[model samples]
Target: MSHQTGIKANEKLIKVFGKSKNGKLRVIKVSIENEELNCTATAEVKKDWERDYDKLIVPLIEESVPCYILYRLDSKTSLGYAWLLLSWVPDTATIRQKMVYASTKATLKNEFGSSHITEELHATNKEETTFDGYIRHKQDFAAPAPLTSREEELVELRKKEINTEINTDTRHQTLGGVTCPMSDATVAAIKDILNGTYDYLQFRIDLEEERIHVSKAAVVPLNELPRQVPTESARYHLYLFKHTYDGNYQESFVFIYSMPGYNCSVRERMLYSSCKAPFLDDLNALGVNVMKKLEIDSGAELTEDFLHDELHPKKFVNSRPAFAKPKGPPNRGPKRLTRPQEQSF
Candidate 1:
């Protein structure tokens, strides 16, 4: 769907946000809403600017499968798009888990720096971060007063402009509620730190340095004494996954998280009973031959596929019916593969 008329880039129909101060890309849930059949979609900052239709974006419109598209919109001149193959497209009642892992990229020298919140981990971008790193914060909060009367007037004018444009913002208006993975653990952690349960522990994180700055005023790192932090249930959900065969069960671990922001990636699932891995390695070993064994089909991810079969996969038999069970872009060039075949490499 090419929304290329008056839609401004500052006000994007699709948004990219979330992910803690860490590199974790906060998982987002999207479903087809008012315009279900409008697969011909496009967005732009200005009407006259060229609209480069990405081939991958076209195949993200499907009925059964909930599509996850990666949109990095800087402006009309600087932009990028891709289709994200979700690991599992759960029902409306989806769960978001808080897991942590460290990945070291072996790029030629060091080319790929962190780009968005979805990008969990990458080599440090010291140069860019030091100069152009932007600190994104919640906007509903109050801001410090401007130094001059002129500045105050400008702020008020800007605020008025924002108010006029607020209704068009579909990004913050979450169409669904998410039950994050660590609800139980998150509750306990917040209760302990945020509540008066503890003596007042101020915690902060430096996104650039990738360091946890925690301490009481005028104190030191937790070097008061040697101790081990809690690594119990924390590890269980870190890379929580299951490995199951037909009736029988096996072990598996997710070798990769989000792919290089591309189209039609297969995130497999298992069927067996439940178990916990206190270590990531133990869980990773379980999913050894997953792609090698189960991947059944591969083909060109064309616009037809994006809007039909390839973008969305079928749900499991026993799964409940989803609330809005349906749901990207323009690629005018010759048809191309919407997704890359994992086995072909």
Candidate 2:
């Protein structure tokens, strides 16, 4: 026995266009070839194209005219093919109309009666509201309310919690040692604790029975750290000794402390040593020699040993022979005049 079978296929939906009361056109419907009311376009208007009664009005419609049919939804009457929607036309402003509007606005008030409109047109072409004005408008719409006493207390508590968390995180990250002093917020918090705003513990450093106690709450401010300002002692010293014997010493000390090496105390001691009067004098002497070699100054204190070691170390090693005076030829007496000279005259 033979049996008959049926087959089915999916179909594509055709788009239907409609016009609004404001004269703006929009897509109305889309459905399968045989299906009714299968899908409809939402209220969102397509930004790039406008749908007229039975046609899509696009910028490129002039290039190739496509056939389109319009249908009335209620009456189901065919409106016929349309190339361009009569409602969709170029919007043009007349000079008189522009002048009338420009005369009222403050921005264009001066340009309304001017001889040339180019200047005013250029100025108005790039007009835009500033960010500050937009932000002010936003704030004006939704202003916050004043906090109550309890709310203020709660805010203070939260602030303290946040500060504590930040401090803990910073300490954990800098477990070895701080590269620099504490920031303003951390310093202020420490100062508050030190001033008895909050209770804090003390740490003791014992050295040979002498105990030096420092409060954990008290922290040096960031401004007190070694900074790049000329007024800072370390920076000032570094500047003065930059071309001197202490140049390398100061650089090494800053690097050692910044990197937090094992011998930090030794580096600190060396820095203090360089700041002494005798060391500073030696550094100044070296600086003077450097300046002299550069032909900038002749008053540099050029000691014999300094000149030998620093200025001409290699030349001093291979001592060149001193220049000797050259011997002159023996002097000769004047010759006596002969009798032939009288004949020549």
Off by over 4 Å in 1: 1-70, 76-97, 101-111, 115-183, 186-345
TM-scores for all predictions = 0.16, 0.13
Candidate 2 C-alpha lDDT tens digits along 1-345: 111111111222222222222223333222212322222232333443223221332221222111111111222113322221111111132222222232222321121111211111111111112223224444754678755656755653453342345554352222222122222333343344434453321222222122222212222232322222211111111111112332443211111012122222333322322323332233244331212221111112223343334433453366788899976566756667767545553
lDDT of each: 0.24, 0.26
Give the best candidate by lDDT: 2
How much lDDT does candidate 1 score? 0.24
lDDT of 2 at 167: 50
TM-score between candidate 1 and the true structure = 0.16
Q: What is the lDDT of residue 242 in candidate 2?
A: 17
Q: How far is candidate 2 from the true structure (C-alpha RMSD, Å)?
A: 31.6
Which pairs of residues have clashing backbones in candidate 2? none
Task: Quote the positional error of residue 263 for candidate 1 in Å.
Answer: 42
lDDT of 2 at 128: 10
